[model samples]
Target: MGQSSSTMSSPVIIPAAARHTATLIFLHGLGDTGHGWASAMAAIRPPYVKVICPTAESMSVTLNAGFVMPSWFDLISLDPNGPEDRAGIEKATNFVHGLIEEELKNGIEASRIAVGGFSQGGGLAIHAALQYPKSLAGIIGLSCWLPLHKDFPKEAKGNLTTRLFQAHGSADPVVPFHWGAETSALLKQFMENSEFKTYPGLSHSSGEQEMEDVKKFLQEVLPDN
Candidate 1:
């Protein structure tokens, strides 16, 4: 699928190589289209897992001097304590929920679907999975922090027990390494089934080891049925 004028760009769909027992809905980072992560995700996903990489709608990002780009929501600043775009985050999270609902309607159980992404998309994925009405199979976030972190554990209603694999580069400059650690700590306060992995010397991107860990996590959480 491709971009559209009235809606979000169509996702890059990688069909399951075997019987489709699970689905992974992955989102791309700011300024990036779904294609950015499609191939990598396709390569790492299990044979029974279908991967869907969705492109975010293009909009003017506040932090980029209002430059129009593909973003899940407007990033006001990198400051963890700074103001957040609550409305925009909620809207994007709702869109994620809609995607999950679509998968559910297509006969995939909520427990057979996972939501994941990188950077900004990963933050949105974390927020969306926590607030979803039904528990998901898993959650994966790489080099990302959680959006609206202050309201969590209380606002988090679903997927508390679902397995989560969060990886961060220790030297990440965009989404600081500290942010990922702090997010992990916050998640552990309420969710016991979460793992936070740190890649040494890495910066702002995924590594071979990290993807291997993610692949293992996916295989464990969405095993063949």
Candidate 2:
């Protein structure tokens, strides 16, 4: 897979091998760089689909005892009902939107793009995709839960009919398995195309089966034309 870094914070881009018809913008988890998911995504994506893996900015995470690390937003607490960094989330969401806008400028329709991520990144993807003003091809989330879930269906004005694939391990410790199930349920309240899968013995990290599922989801949603 070809790789290039145009700027200090630029994403690790895997250009489409053939005519670019679709784009997948995948975000990395906390403390990880875009390079972490680059090769994996490239292996699964079709030649006509360009993969863009964007790294999160470095910031101090309260959950990590104020240690600086690459994170999409500040994790003030792990409590599902605890305080959230709304400002930080908004900033990151705007950044994701900017990436989508750039692809649109490059002639890729909003419907030809998919946004997804893992863990913290996955939460951000769900939040950003739901708030996006245009319809996206799909949304993928792995081992993730919605960050500010209270404002849903109402705040989620766009992509109501868009397809969503969310997966979580039954033994996930970081983000409880129930959170994923609840998120799927909440999303289903308005999004009829949502699907949630459970991994029997999986943990906080992804497995071979999960990746295969993601590959199929990508193929189904962003098929080559």
Candidate 3:
């Protein structure tokens, strides 16, 4: 899926049946493609919303038993001290920004777009939305960690009063619920009324409740038509 020498391919526009200008740009996780979690659409479907799902550049997924799969970067280790692929990170940032610009060009306001993802993709969405320099309609992360290791610049934080919906299973092994909680806290520390909910017994997979939460988030963030 490396259409360019970057960590993210261009957005694949999936038009909703209604001519809604709002967009949800979804990024998938490690070992997954854009289509991997496309089922999220059904959970999010409302009249007049378009969703863009982009595949990450394919890289050999070493942590997942060395199987080659689509991924944003190599997680040298789970430790903070581990090496990181800076190039991949930069490419991902650029690709996400490019998608936002293109969506605005297509007539959607910056405030009409939300970014959501699962796992590593979720991490990217958190980082990207925090730096997006304008208020988003919303941001959602499922089964992913917060990218607070990188600071969100002051200007973006000032403009980001947008709603946030984050759901993580309390018993998730890959991404602990605490991560989501901390991200929510951090967001509220800078913005207003960011929402975070944790499912008590759910796992890394998005439970039905979490998907329902996404609908609620969209209902709260999207403009009433």
Q: Estimate each model's TM-score.
A: 0.96, 0.95, 0.86
Candidate 1 CA-lDDT value: 0.91
The candidate maximizing lDDT is: 1
Model 1, runs deviating above 4 Å? 1-5
What tens digits encode model 3's per-residue C-alpha lDDT throughout 1-225?
Answer: 444564455555678668776888888888778777665764575667788888887776656666777887666556543566666665676678888898899899988888888988887787778767777788887877655344544535433676767778989888767776766776677766566788999988877778877887777777666
Candidates, ranked, TM-score: 1, 2, 3
What is each predicted model's overall lDDT from 0 to 1?
0.91, 0.90, 0.74
Question: Which candidate has the highest TM-score of all?
Answer: 1
For candidate 3, the TM-score is: 0.86
Query: What does the lDDT read for residue 184 in candidate 1?
Result: 94
**Residue 214 of model 1, lDDT score:** 87
Stretches of candidate 3 exceeding 4 Å from the true structure: 1-3, 6-12, 61-67, 80-83, 153-159
Output the TM-score of candidate 1.
Answer: 0.96
